[model samples]
Each structure stands twice: as C-alpha cells, then as structure tokens.
Target: MGVWHRSLSRFFSPDEPHAAEPQVDQESNLHLEKPISEPLLKAISTNDLPTLRALLETQDRQLFSQIAQNGTPEAAAYLLSRHTVPEDYSQYIGSADPILHPTQYLIRESARYGNAPLFRYLLTQYPAIFSSQRWNNESILLSAMQGGVGIWRVILDYYPAWKDAEFAGHHGCVLEFLVDRDKKELIEFLLQEGLDTDRAGDPVLELARRRGAGKEVLDLIRKYGG
Candidate 1:
C-alpha cells in the first residue's frame, strides 16, 4: 500500500476527496482514473440503490460481475442479492485491469471509507471476500488502520488472528502516521489490538519519542509490548 495519488470522484461525491490510493495500469494500458462510464459505478457512487438493482437485473452477467468485483460494500450486497458467488471465482470477479482485484478493492474501499454499517453489511453478506487465503491480510489491516479505530475494530472482531499480521515496509503502517498526528486514542487502540510497534522505517516507540508523544501515550506503547 505504498501511497499512490488518485481521484475520489469515481467512488464518492466529487466534492469529497478520498484518501485511498488511485491506480493506473501502465502495462495493460488501462486508464483506471478515467471518468466513470459504467452505469453500475455511477449508481453505486451516487448511492442509488434502485438503479443498481435495475442494472443488475438488466445488464449482461459478466458486465455486472466486472463492475461489482471492485464495487463498494452496498453495491456488493445488491450484486450478491441477485447473483450467486461464482464457483470458478475468478470467472465472476475480475476486470481488464488485473490490479483492481475485487478482494483487494473491496477491502481497501470498505476499510478506508470508515463506514461501519456498510462494512459490516459486506462482511456479513460476503464473508469469503476477505478470506485470508484469498486476500492480503496486510492490506486489509493497513487500510483498516487508516479508517480509524471503529473500522479497525470491526475487522478485528471478525478475524482475531489478523491482529498480529506483520506489515511490510511498503504497506504504509499507520503507527508512524498516528504518532505524527498525536492520535493517542487510535494509537492506543492499535496497540491494545496487538499491532507490532516494531516497524522497518521507524519503530513506534522511537517515533513517539522523536515526535514528543505525551507520557500517557509512551506508557501505552510500553504497556502493549512496543
């Protein structure tokens, strides 16, 4: 999850810029950043559930499958309502741009958006979407951390083992960001959830010290085995 700049307009109101990384496929020559053309994408971004339902019913199955693969949680639920999860899973959930796999896209969107109800709904409706064997746990964890404590907690409650998932240097661990922002509560919550304070770039304890973390925050890091 090394940072990549992208527009939020494709997934949200144009006025609201999303923090999630934008993607472009150079080799495949897919312009992912291009304006939204798919009707499903427009419907999902606008929260127009009825139009989404109509599109799902009237469109080609593969078209619905391609769009839904990288859709938001609400859109995913609606897509699932009409279509069964594909048995040859890849057949039902891929696009011209392989980088935007549904599993990763869904996790990134659900976690970074910080919508607890929608996140929970997607999890409940399509638990397999985030199965550790299929999706990157590190990506899920990093994105959840960016989403704040509430979203992180939802995923943690669902998959306790992920609490210990080690982050790669490129995954953009949230500890440094949290310490930089002096977000003590979120830092503490992450520590309590058992995220390792030891990172490749800057260990949480050292970063906190350099950033002049409050006494309470330092104590929390140590208390949680930083």
Candidate 2:
C-alpha cells in the first residue's frame, strides 16, 4: 500500500484527539497569519479550485491520506476533479508495481469525504483512479462498501468497471455497508448481480448471520444472498 501512515504519537495526542473535522471555517483561514500548511486546509474548506490544484501538484504523495482526512470536503472535491499526473502514466505501468500518483490522491480524499461530485469526476476524468488500492488491502469497491450506499451509488453509476461489487466474503455478499441506513434496494441490486444465498462471495451476509444481526438486516442479507 502506498498510503502514508499517521505517527502513533499523533494518534494518541491528547491536545488534538482527532476532531471529526479538520477545521470549520475554510475560507477566512486562508488569510490568517498562522502558517503555510494552514492554507491547504483553508483552500479545501472553501472550495478554492485553483489553490487546491497548485498545492496538489507540488505536495508530497506520502502526505496524500493525511490531506484527505484533514482537508475540507469541499476543497477535497475541487482538487480531486483537477488532479492529473505526468504524461508518463503508462510508462510507469510496465514497472513491477504501479503508482497512480495524484489520481490516488483524489481517490483517497473522495473516499474520506464521500463526496459524490468528486467521486463521479474521478470515475469520468480519471477512470484509472478506480484501480488504485485503498487502505487495509481493499479495492475501491471495498471503499464504496465500507462507505455505504451513497458511495456505492456514486461508484456504480460513474465507474461501471466495478466488476467485484459484491464479491464473496465471510458473509457471502450480504455484509455490504449501510446497515444503519438500511440500504435494502442496494442489497437487492447486489443479488441481481448474481450473489446467491451460498457463501460464494457474501462477506456482508456472513457478518450479519454470524453476529446475530437484527431481523431487518438479516432479511436484507438473505434477500440479497438468495
């Protein structure tokens, strides 16, 4: 995984215990006399497309995920739409492994924010972003799965190449995300894709059944599993 890992110290920092968001006001913060790094946050929050573009071009790839987690959802969406790589994208392909560079940046940030516009842009402008790996050894499919139906719909409509939407897993195919939101139609769509009640590829179902998932959730799992 090319993803950057946050320091253990940062994780446990009592002063900044990982607020749900990076900063509230993304616009005014851009002009504050704080620091250079502060602008990145501001640019993201305010949806300053040009500033985000400039920063993404020059920023270190390793810090991509941190930016994703820290940037405002608005700015993240803006930058993701503008991301591009060196002309040698395919040249790097023949190498043993691949690095999608800025495209990966967009994917990570879009996943973090669940921004439909940004995700859709990637699927259109940079189809290659879908192939980029996510953290925890998951694919973009897993990203959408973990993110729930909003993400799922965004990916499905824009990224038709998602052949593994409901691949086999512990729950066969019923362990899809959106448990709290009860994405029943999404589950049914998965079933239409060929995920039967068997354990061929139903991690969602496996998770629900093994954990004694609620009746509605189980019904969803089985409904799709069948």
Best by TM-score: 1
Top candidate on lDDT is 1
Q: What is the TM-score of each candidate against the true structure?
A: 0.48, 0.46
lDDT of 2 by residue, 39-146 (tens): 777998999999987775455443444444443444444444454545332222212121255554445455545655555655666555445332212445545554
| Runs with alpha carbons beyond 4 Å of true place in candidate 2 | 1-100, 131-138, 159-208, 222-225
- The alpha-carbon deviation from the true structure for residue 31 of candidate 1, after best TM-score superposition, in angstroms, is 32
Expressed as tens digits, the lDDT of each residue in 16-64 for candidate 1 is 3442344545732344434444787899999999998776544434433
Name the runs in model 1 displaced over 4 angstroms: 1-75, 80-104, 132-135, 169-182, 194-204, 210-216, 222-225
Model 2 scores a TM of: 0.46
Worst 10 residues of 1 by lDDT: 1-10
